[model samples]
Target: GKGGAEAGAIGNISIYDVDFVPLLDAAGQPVDPNPVGHGLTEIDHLTHNVFRGRMKEWSEFYERFFNFREVRYFDIEGKLTGLKSKAMTSPCGKIRIPINESS
Candidate 1:
C-alpha cells in the first residue's frame, strides 16, 4: 500500500493470512489456564470443533462468555449447506469471530 490516501479510497486491500500459536507453558505441555483459553496448540488453518448443542444457546454462550456480538449472518442452501455467521468486536476491537451452524 504505497499510496496512503489513495489506498484508503480504494476498498480492495490484501489482509495477509494468520498462523496462530497458542501461548505455551513451562512444562512443554498444553496449559489449561482456564476453560476459555487453554489446551494450547497451533494449527495451519482455522479448525473449529464446535460442541453439540442448540444454535441459540451457542450464540448466547458467545455473547455471555466471549462477549462477541453477532455482526453478519448467511444462510447456506446447497447439499453441504447450513447457517454461517460472523461475530465482530464486543469486548476487544481487534478480535474477529466467525461461527458456522453445527451439522
Candidate 2:
C-alpha cells in the first residue's frame, strides 16, 4: 500500500508490514499511535492444556478464580488424538478460555 498497509494487532500496536513507511503528517509530525487496526478486540478465546481426565478441575478453576462460567463443551476423537474441551468465559462474556485435554 502506498500509504502503508496494516497487519493484525500485537497487543495494542498495529503492525505495518513495510520496511519504510512513515506514520507522519505533512509537517513530519507524529500521527495517531493507533494507526488503524491497532487495538485488540474482545478476546475471542485462549487455548490451553489440561491433563487428560482433568477437564473438570481446570474448568472449576476458571469458575472460581475469574468467576468464569462454562459456556461450551466439546469432545472429539481424531484418528491420532482424542480431545475433550471446555470453554469458559468471564461474566462479561469478553474473555474466553478454552481448555483442552488431548490424548
The TM-score obtained by model 1 is 0.40
Off by over 4 Å in 1: 1-53, 86-88
The sequence of per-residue lDDT tens digits that candidate 1 reaches over residues 66-87 is 7877766655557865554444
> What lDDT does model 2 reach?
0.80
Query: What is each predicted model's overall lDDT from 0 to 1?
Result: 0.54, 0.80
Error of 1 at 37 (Å): 23
Model 2 TM-score relative to the real fold? 0.59
Worst 10 residues of 2 by lDDT: 12-21
Per residue, candidate 2 scores C-alpha lDDT tens digits across 1-103 of 3245556756745554443455788999977766688777666788989788888898888898889998889889899989888888899988889999985
C-alpha positional error of residue 41 in candidate 2 after TM-score superposition, expressed in Å: 3.9
Q: Count steric clashes of candidate 2.
A: 0
Candidate 1 weakest lDDT stretch, 10 residues: 14-23
- Candidate 2 runs further than 4 Å off: 1-37
